[model samples]
Target: MPAGVLFMFIIVFTTLVAVRMNSYVISALIIYVFFSIIGAVDDIAKVINQRKIAKGLISKQDYQYKADGISAGLRLFLYMTISLLVAMAAYKYIPNINGDINLPFISIVKRFPSLPFWLFIPFMTFTIAIFANGVNFTDGFDTLATVPSICCFVFVGIISFISSNSIWSNYLLIPHIVGLQEILPLIGAVIGTLLAYLWFNSPPSTIIMGDSGSVGLGGLIGILFIFTKAGFYLPLVGFIFFMEFASVAIQIGYFKLTGKRVFLMAPIHHHFQIMMRKSGLYKGEFQIKSKIAWRFHILSVVCLVLGLALFLKIR
Candidate 1:
């Protein structure tokens, strides 16, 4: 079985055992499970395609037999559908959370309030989809997604605990979210599973989490942000994933509009790897050493998380 399947089981079982289910947590978990299902379907399709190709059951030139797991349109449709369902459920079930958008580092008194439900639904859906794909794109290297994700979950789990407690929420000048504390176990479960998976997924990986894991994890992170009213912090907390997605977006947009490529490769990590090789910093044909890549990425994530935490504490 794919490691992702095992990871999902771990998440579900741990959440069930560790946290009492409430409407809010249940809705969030449902969204996470749905995203995982989409990923599993895609993984299955990819594996099947690979098997067919390897067996010479299908020719590469056959348009219908293209090895790409799922068409972008189909995947987008599924993502949007899932996002809409989750958004609707959140709107109906999650209390003390509405269309208010809080700006991070700003005074708690100020917020973008009373955003119409129609507008908020689409916006929330877009947020989930963007984060999900951002994570999917960032899973290019071993531990690239896993370790940073663990950091994100840890930080978010802390924030969730703080947000849920009225005393801490007032002291921190953040929104007080009732029942948000229930989601902490889900966060803990994710952290535990990722740590276990890291044993085989670190440098020179024996297994890859692939889309099934990355997308699901990303969606869960997005939901956690929404529930805790910490959506703005996502850019800071998930800085690496944000940069990876942004690099790809900018590279594609720039190349198409200016007839020039921004980087040797899309996704900044791969670009750095290419640069390291071309600069003669590494001896191997692969310029980016796995150890270097892992260390650099991990350090970047840790610094960002700690910096954000300190800023939040002192501000």
Candidate 2:
């Protein structure tokens, strides 16, 4: 069973019970479930392909596309289209969710650089699509994506709490977005779901949160950043996910341009794994993986703290 199935249920149930079904939470849940459905389609396709291969009904080489889940091209198309629609909806329906954004280290008074709709819509769509893939890429390792995701939600929750209150927003010099607090329960539910996921996804994981969970979580996080007007802080709050995504992009781009590989493998974590294996310092796969997981977890924590301090206290 795809772990995302459980994640969906838990998040939905927890959020609904913990908070009133306000417009903010309702919109968030709808957007989250929409992206999750896209991911679930890919997951289901991969499972069907695996079963076919196991039964010798289809050759693995011939069905390689299916084995890898939905084709990358199709998945990208879906991501772009669905996220664009979501962005449009947010702009049209959500209050105070305009092109204005919050920047780190800048007073919110000066940071409200209002962008034109054309640019803002595409930017929002790009953010949602990119982070969805970023989390998906980071999910390559056990428990790697979970910590960072939890950290991100924690940041979003704090920012939302601050943004919803006039006094705190004024004190912090952040935007006072009405109804923003309504999404706190959703953020809390997501954090709780990830923590529950971590219990099983710790090193030597029994169940992996495949693309279904990763993509959904990533997409939701991206939207949360926008909704909270903290989109600029994504690079800091989601530092690990950004690095993972950047490594792959750099490796591929560099290889195509110069016919040279940047790392032993794409995704910095895998490069580290290959390096450790080559160094003969680690005794086995478990040790190398454990080291990587712990290091990334610590990095996520540091980024979370720095991001919060810079956004809230550094004024």
Model 1 C-alpha RMSD to native: 2.6
- How high is the lDDT of residue 196 in model 1? 87
Per-candidate alpha-carbon RMSD to the true structure: 2.6, 1.7
| Candidate 1, backbone clash total | 0
Top candidate on TM-score is 2
TM values, all candidates: 0.90, 0.94
lDDT by residue (tens digit), candidate 2, 1-315: 569867888888888888877666776787678778888888888888888899999997967756557688888898899889888887888768679987766676765677789989998998888898899889877898999999999999999998899998998888899988988888988888888888988777889887779888998898889888878889899998889889999999999999999998988899999999999998999999989998999999999999999888663
lDDT of 2 at 157: 93
Q: How does residue 110 of candidate 1 score in lDDT?
A: 57
Error of 1 at 46 (Å): 1.9
Off by over 4 Å in 1: 58-67, 110-114, 285-292, 299-307, 310-315
